[model samples]
Target chain A: MIAPLLQGFLDEFERLEAAMPGYEQAWLRQLRRDRLDAFVTSGLPGRREEAWKYTPLKGLEQRAFALPRGSALPPPLPPPLDAVRHRLVFVDGRFAPESSRLPADAEIEFLPLSEVFRNHDAAARFRIARLMGSGEDALDHLNAALATDGLLLRVPAGRSVREPVHLVYLGSKQSSGRAWHLRGLIELEGGARLRIVEHFYDGGEEAELSSVINEIQLAADAELELVRFQDMGARSILLSRTRLQVEARGRLRITAIDRGGELVRSEWLTTLRGREAHGDIAGVARLRGRQHADQVVEVRHLERDTSAEVRFRGVAEDQSRAVFTGTLHVAPGASGAETRLSSRNLLLSPQAEVDTRPVLEIHHDEVVAAHGATVGQLDPEALFYLRSRGFSETMARAILIGAFLEEISIRLPEPRFAEWVSSRMGLDHPLPWGGEKT
Target chain B: MLEIVDLHVSVGGTPILKGLDLRVPRGEVHAIMGPNGAGKSTLAYVLAGKEGYERTRGDIRWDGKDLLSLAPEQRAIAGIFLAFQYPVEIPGVNNAYFLRTAVNLKRKARGEPELDAVEFLRAARERLRLIGSDDGLLQRGLNEGFSGGEKKRNEILQMLMLEPELAILDETDSGLDIDALRLVASGVNALRSPERAFLVITHYQRLLEHIVPDRVHVLAEGRIVASGGPDLAQRLEREGYGWLAERRRASEALG
Candidate 1:
């Protein structure tokens, strides 16, 4: 029997397909059908799944979510970022054309993804397929069948975008009991450089759940710096999948910040397909209350001379739990590749839990790979050391935990941006002493 | 201004400090020189109120108040300081920020205003320069990846910044080079005042030559066996703990 949690999705899929625009192409329809069938067969991951054993989705088992509609012109909320220019806003799964803006020296292309699918003929379908990954999972199928609107960016060859692009997803009041599927397609041509900041925020109780799949492709010698900040409310659930492929000598760096959620799981996979490519991924999560967060990452080095560094830092307080797992694998041909993974977690409460695992699988003996994982509470010696210097117990613990998370925060490409993200989520408190909330 | 009377401390299941009694008056720097496992570190940990140390029988007073009743941080604000025998490496905590929080907390407890980051930085930078420390050292994690001498020096730097009335130096000169020992001892000497006191716990007499204590106490088997002037530390240096061990054996036999 199909799990009741996923049964409603089949009906929702039928409704979305009936209302969605531009299915004149039989190929796209077939692709969506296959994905839906795959989800029906495999179903949502259960407690028995080794990767999801610690975090269960019991709350989502009995809920039903429908797609929320968006407006062509929507009122603007206060911009979360101060220094960054050119932001593409999507509220309630629909791109807000009026709320979006582009730079004056805009040499790149930025268009609504729905518009691309609508205008592209059968011949142009190759681009769509390239952006759509294997499309193999429940959310992947859901995203394939029901994605409403997204931002499509194309940076030309040999040109670098100086200003960072902000992909802001806002959940509106009408989004209650609604789940949105968002897909972003980003392509950086050969030798091109671009930085994209993907931001996800639930306005309040109205927006409850969302699934996002972002596709990023870097060409030869191209460089892409992407940062993701998820600051959803405690009542919200968000699942995000970010996948990227780097060509020869291309560099891709992603820094993700998760500031608590009712349930949050982020899957990040990167493939280094060319020689001398570098992949650097770092994420930090600060969970409190009954919130839960999971970060799963996989890095594949398929070519020689590739290097990747992955690190995750997490803090769980109250009755919350945080899980982080990183896997690095080097193919036989990628003999000269080097990879390193580090996952560090701090559990602030006895009820809180953290699971960290770092795995390295190397098919080539010539490659250098190392991984380390640690899960522990605040060091008592460190705590006493701070207290001996007159820091109160709470202040001492905050300093140590915040500092532990700073390993990821300090390395953000934008320091002010990092601070903004932290302060908004109550994760970054620079004060030596703070209220009981910290 | 610090007094420890009939101090008894136990670690795990065994007693480490048994009936240790000592009085360090104001305007004096007392030296505690003992051999390995002589409870020198235990005494410091017990006085600082470190957890896991059970004090079954002890009374410690600082500045006419019951210091043992206070928490570790409370005792700190009450003008009691312990330069740890092995300073802990606090990963990710900023050194400068840590020192400032310490100074400001003590100040707040004493009914003084807390310094802002700018003011704290100015004050800390001045003290850091006075102690010949790299200004950038604070930018890194507190005592993380610090060299042996640097860690000891960092302890002294905190001591200098906090200016505790009664400071306990627990083997602060153990891993130091001759130069580091001189710098740390000088830092301590510079903080000496008629209204303040110090309890320097060390295993070597080389530190005494730098700070020149007012009195030296020899602790053997968890209790003070002898108390004398600086000449005692000089003798402990010339001749190791062999003489003290023999004296303790003879005293036990006579008893």
Candidate 2:
């Protein structure tokens, strides 16, 4: 029975391959073949694996998901960027080009993953091999086998892109029992700088599962800032996995803000491969109404003189649950490496729950690595102090909660993004500090 | 004007102030010098309505109203201020912010207009400089890292900012150096007016030299054992409270 299901997935994969008539990338063809083979052999991950303990894939067997139709293009692009830059909008795993906004920048290159595979063999092969790896996870295989449209980004050396690149994935309209497979690859050459924002939104009330994979490579002295915000509607299951590699003197900062979903899980894996590389990861999850948000991060310092910091804050209210697990590993001979991981949670309601686990694995003797986790409610004395100053009880509690999450929100480079997150957390009010409200 | 009639207080179910009686008319500064464990601090806390210090049998009237019936914040609006001996350190709460909120709370309660940030800053800066402190203290967390003398000076600064009608300096000069003591006393003196009354509680008579009092009382065993003029402080400083305790014991035995 499982073999036929696998075969059915392969038949759909073949249909998608035949539809792309002009694509001629040999390496991508080979990568797809290899991934399919791996999937046939490895099948799906079992519950015994430590990483898959909290999330299970048993629901996939209950129903078969249809391939997204590519007939309807996306709506009109948003703004001025619609002129120059290339755009690829995915709706339920199908490509929607009309809704994308592209800008005109010399060093900027954006294309569908199929085009990249057909034209740029070396880059396409590198990205595919890097993403697939040797792990035969069912989700990875399924994504490779069934992916309809993938977004590809490339930035040349010594060039900086001012306008932000946007990739938006919208689910099917009013469709239930469907699934989406999204694959994205971003490459930054030496001395290159890029800022990208990706948003995942859905308009349907159906039950759907989304498996997304993003791979980022930062060359020497390159700088990259990526912001990923997910606001999928209720009755949705999303699993997003991101892998990042930073070279010498390179910098990477990623911020993930999550809200509005029944069960959303995000995993971030980063490696500092060269000396003096820096990576900072920060995320905030606001949940309510029985929603569940899980964030798992793994940062490894593989060379000397590298540093990484991971900070996560979550606010759970109204029977919501949040889970955070951050692991920092320092390889041997990685001296002078400093890694700090902190996870703090605020529980606003009695029934709401938060689980935080911070782990540190240090093999180097001359490194500074520490991890801290805290989960609690607001302080009573602080609340009383604010209330005594004429602020209403509700406003006082909100201020205290906002102050607790301010440290993470302050790390966002853009004021608008910071304000968005603050407003989402209900912290845009004037706080009682320094005599005046802030 | 304030009156304390048969004020009795206890802490942890142990009586600290036993049938204490005192009265301060408007615009008068009365100094109460007491021996150790004379319930001096207890009296200050009871008047300020701090927790853990319960007034079992007492009637405190302020400005012709029952003061004991009000909460700490209400009393603050009614023009009562307590300059603590050991100022509490509230971390993460900026000093200026804390003071401004307190001042505004009292102002709003009295139907006065609230002061904006710029106006409050100007007024606070002038007051802080007048008390020999700088604006840097305003940026720091409220008394978190303050030295002993600095904490005492901050208490006086708060008293000055709040400007209550009935001010109680509870050993405000306890841990100050000579310069700080003089600065704090001068600040208190600057705030003294005919429309306000002051109750200065202290262990020694040294503070009296800077801010002279109209009357001095010696408290022993939770009650006023002797009352006299400024010379009484001098006499107690010389003779100590050993004789006063002896006389109190003998009088209790005779009764």
Separate DockQ for every predicted complex: 0.41, 0.13
Which pairs of residues collide in candidate 2?
Answer: A25-A118, A84-A103, A84-A104, A85-A102, A85-A103
Clashes of each: 0, 5
Docking class of 1: acceptable
RMSD of each: 3.8, 5.9
Tens digits of per-residue lDDT for model 2, A1-438: 665546656666677665642235555566677777777677655567666655555544545555554554443333322443434577776556656656554458777765554565565667655654533577677777556457777898978987667677777645566666778778899989998777777775678778788788899999998777787767788878888999999998988887747778898999999999999999888888888888989999999999998999899999988888898999999999999998989998999889788888999999998889988888765654444334456765766666666555555545554555456556543332112331
Q: Candidate 2's error at A155, in angstroms?
A: 2.7
Q: Taking the tens digit of each residue's C-alpha lDDT, what string does model 2 give over B106-213?
A: 788888998777888888888888779988777776787999988888878788888889999999889788888888989989998999999999999899989999
Number of colliding residue pairs in model 1: 0
Q: What do the candidate models score in CA lDDT, each in turn?
A: 0.81, 0.76
Write down the TM-score for model 2. 0.75
What are the per-residue Cα lDDT tens digits for candidate 1 across A244-318? 899999999998888768788998989999999999999988888998899989999999999999999888889
Candidate 2 accuracy as lDDT: 0.76
